[model samples]
Target: MRYAKWTILTLLALTVFGFFHYTLPQHDIVRIVNTYQERQDLDDWTRIFWASPDDQATGLINRDVQFIQAVDADGKPHVYRNEDTGWSWPPYFKFDTANLQTQAEDLKSTAEAPKWVSVTHYGWRIVYLSTFPNAISVRPVEGPDATIIPWVNIVILTFLAVILFMLRRMWLQFRERMIDPMVEDAEEAWDSVDARADQAAAKARGLWGRFRAWLDTWKGRPRR
Candidate 1:
């Protein structure tokens, strides 16, 4: 049971970590290499990885998706899907897919004359599933090694930490002030019941002993 409890806690912790990692915005400094549109099939299991911008698009089996291809400072390739998140999950409210694609096109450059840009995005690139991170925004940066201060992420993480701390404190207080006393009272009630049961048993034994003494007396045996 103890091992099972630890395993559950471990799994819970990993799940929370994965949730935040996938939902939270991330930054990638890279040089725009190319942009294109491709019809992506959404009928398979990978449908969840794609964006559901509106109700009409939800029923479609395939749709044209804009893509931004880039290479990072280490020459590592990155592909980002350009799609409007609408007013959906993650709540990015990105409705400028065309505008972002245009921006990426305008910033395209060769490795020799590369223009560094910071691509702010969320999600993950799983090659096996053909999943690409959804690009949220993009802007020109000084260079490949430009020190980008993730003020948004820092603020968000800090806020979440504060909220979690407050919630934990509230839960602890609730258990102490409400649950603990109720549990103690129930234990005390159970103890009282046990005491009554023991007394009743003792009384029954005494009555039986007296009855035996009387029976012995009737049988010509002396009583103490």
Candidate 2:
């Protein structure tokens, strides 16, 4: 049971960690190499990775998706899908897909004369699943080694920590003030019932013993 409890806790922690890792914004310092638009088929399970830019387009089987191609400081390639989240999960509320695509195009650079830029995005690039991280924003950086401070993630995580701490404190207070008193009262009531039952049993035994002694007197034996 102890092992099972720890296993459950471990799995729960991993799940929460994965959820935050996927949802929270991440940064990649890369040089934009290209930008293009292509028709994407969304009639499969991979649709979850894409966005619903239009409410009416939700039922559509396919749509045109813009993409940005870039390479990291190590010269490794990365592809990001440009889509509007617009009142959806992750809540970036991005509606500037065209503007972002233009920015990516303008920032395009060759291998020798690289103009490094930071791509702020969320999601994962799963090649096997044909899913790309959705790019949120793009901004130029001093160099590929620019130190970007993740202030947004820091604020969000700190706020969440404070909330969890407050909730735990509330739970502890409730247990101390309400639940503990009720439980103690129940235990005391049960103890009193057991005491009464023991007293009744002793009284019954005493009466039966006295009756036996009286019978012994009739038989000419001295009463006990």
Candidate 3:
């Protein structure tokens, strides 16, 4: 019974911890990102932004996570929809590229790039392609070259590792607290516990390996 509960907890932890980073419009091959930073406050970790199309005061209520396209005009960035006229955002792909490197030294004085960032531009849209593990903000799908090396997946991997460790600890505690002293025939019960645990673990490992393998093979683009 305790093992069942612990198993459930482990599964739940993996589910929750799996959300290492926010990826929007998962159907897209490339994620859209903010290009012009002077007027934007992108929160890459959550893939949210400080401001939105309407209502820009001094609170977090205006934060938006949707992909946006830059209007060709030099006005403030607006909420671009699929139906918007001219320079509209598609389902995926875009970037803004106003890098802050030469701004500080020049009198033009453009907006500074955020403390941690790696940006790339795709026409009117911007894509944040990568960042450090502990950065506060990042572009949507913009960290650690996800296809080659999924850092967020690594975080989730660590989460699974910790969960496995805790489950092992719990199993040990369960044995010590519930089963060890209770069984009169210690030898037989011990043998049974060892056999059942080994079987269950082996089965779980095989299932996990198969699942991961299937996930890897699911990488190609879907048919139209």
The model with the greatest TM-score is 1
User: For each predicted model, how many residue pairs clash, with residues at least 3 apart or on different chains?
Assistant: 0, 0, 13
lDDT of 2 by residue, 78-196 (tens): 99999999898879989999999999999999998999999999999999999999999999999999999999999999999999999999999999999999999999999999999
- Name the regions of candidate 3 deviating beyond 4 angstroms: 1-18, 21-147, 177-180, 183-224
lDDT of 1 by residue, 77-137 (tens): 9999999999888889999999999999999999999999999999999999999999999
Tens digits of per-residue lDDT for model 3 on 97-190? 1222222112121233222122222122233532111111223333223333445446756898999899999999999888887875788889
Between prediction 2 and prediction 3, the one with superior TM-score is: 2
What is the Cα-based TM-score of model 3? 0.27
Is candidate 1 or 2 superior in TM-score?
1
**What is the clash count of model 1?**
0
Off by over 4 Å in 1: 207-224
RMSD of each: 2.9, 3.1, 25.1
Top-down lDDT ranking? 2, 1, 3
| Local distance difference test scores for all models | 0.94, 0.94, 0.39
